[model samples]
Target: MTDLELTELVKEISLADFGKAFKHQAMFNRRLRTTGGRYMLQSHHIEINPASYKEFGTDELVGIIKHELCHYHLHIEGRGYLHRDRDFRELLEQTGSPRFCSLVQSKARTKPVKRYIYACIDCRCEYARKIRMNTARYRCGKCNGKLRLKSE
Candidate 1:
């Protein structure tokens, strides 16, 4: 659906579920790969993943809208809007909103594999890092010793 349609749907859901008006923008965000929707704190805008409707259909879309609405309403009224907040959780349960958006596994959760290892020449202390560094400019904090690059 288009952004205008999404905005209307959000407004409809907000009034129906929360009995509050959604006076903000709702748009289809193609870049939102990890979550179905997100409510922006700064702009109070709701971004819905269009792919979610294609993949999960209207029911999931409604749920996402409700979830974002929870955040939207609470944040606007100076109440706790974060997922961990008691007010947010209560709103979720009262509105039957999902705790999280579906199919939102972020690739950023996994730490990158370390590629470079450095060790102090005198203290034998080791440091693992993801990127290579200029050893000439830095030294070990444990001792004022020269550092050497060690192969993994």
Candidate 2:
């Protein structure tokens, strides 16, 4: 969502749940890597990770919003707003917000490992390759040593 949309969502949640108004900014911060969202204590702004919505959809997005609101409301009211604070934990439980911001697990990679290690028999020069090279035709330039497959 755009910054304006995020602002609206935060305002809505604040009013609905906390009976307060969110007077600060809320935006989707593309730079957020692992955290689903963050509440900026200095700016009193909320930053949501765009990847969270892209990967998990609106339901997940709302949860993140709720999580940030927990921080926002508590901090603005001069109560404990940190995750470890008693007030923060109580507020989260009262608001039914998640204790921690959820993260989108990154996609798994399946690329094959470069399993073969090759070495020149005479010069001991080493090489690594994903695919086995033809040792019969390949030789060490330094010593003209025949290359051999040393390990997989």
Candidate 3:
């Protein structure tokens, strides 16, 4: 969705869930990485990770907005606003906001499935394996040495 849509969604969530108006600006930040959204203390503005929408769709966007709203409302009320605060936790529960921002990764962005990479303990020869092999049972084909984990 566009930045305007995200802004509107944030406002809607703030009012509907918190019964408080969000007076600050909300915008999409393409540079944001890993984090779903961030609440700026200085400006009281909320910046949402655009990657979140691209990866997890509108539902995820709503959840992130709700989470930021919790921070926004609590901070404005002079209550505990950090994630570790009891008031913040309670407000999150009450407002049905997600406690943590989950990683939103696109399936299309993933590389072809490659499970394991077995390497020779002695020569360091790597072998890509689709299935897990018993290290004790299987030896490296190159030098007949024990294999070690090179990849997950």
- Give each model's clash number: 0, 0, 0
Error of 3 at 54 (Å): 1.0
RMSD of each candidate?
A: 3.5, 7.4, 7.2
Task: Summarize candidate 3's per-residue lDDT along 62-91 as a digit string, tens digits.
Answer: 889999998899999999999999999999
The sequence of per-residue lDDT tens digits that candidate 1 reaches over residues 20-134 is 9999999998898878889999999999888787877899999999999999999999999998899999999999999976684442257789999999999999999998999
Worst 10 residues of 2 by lDDT: 101-110
Whichever of 1 and 2 has more lDDT, that candidate is: 1
Candidate 1 wrong stretches, greater than 4 Å? 104-152
- Give each model a TM-score: 0.69, 0.69, 0.68
Tell me how far the alpha carbon of residue 52 in candidate 3 is from the true structure, in angstroms, after superposition: 0.8
Question: Over the stretch 1-152, how does candidate 2's per-residue lDDT look in tens digits?
Answer: 67898788888888998888889999998888868899999999999889889998988888888989988888888999888999989888898888765557773335778889998887799888898889888888788889999999
Candidate 2: residue 87 lDDT (0-100): 96
TM-score of 3: 0.68
Candidate 1 — what's its lDDT? 0.90
Can you tell me which runs of candidate 3 are displaced by over 4 Å?
106-152
**Between 1 and 3, whose lDDT is larger?**
1
What TM-score does candidate 1 reach? 0.69
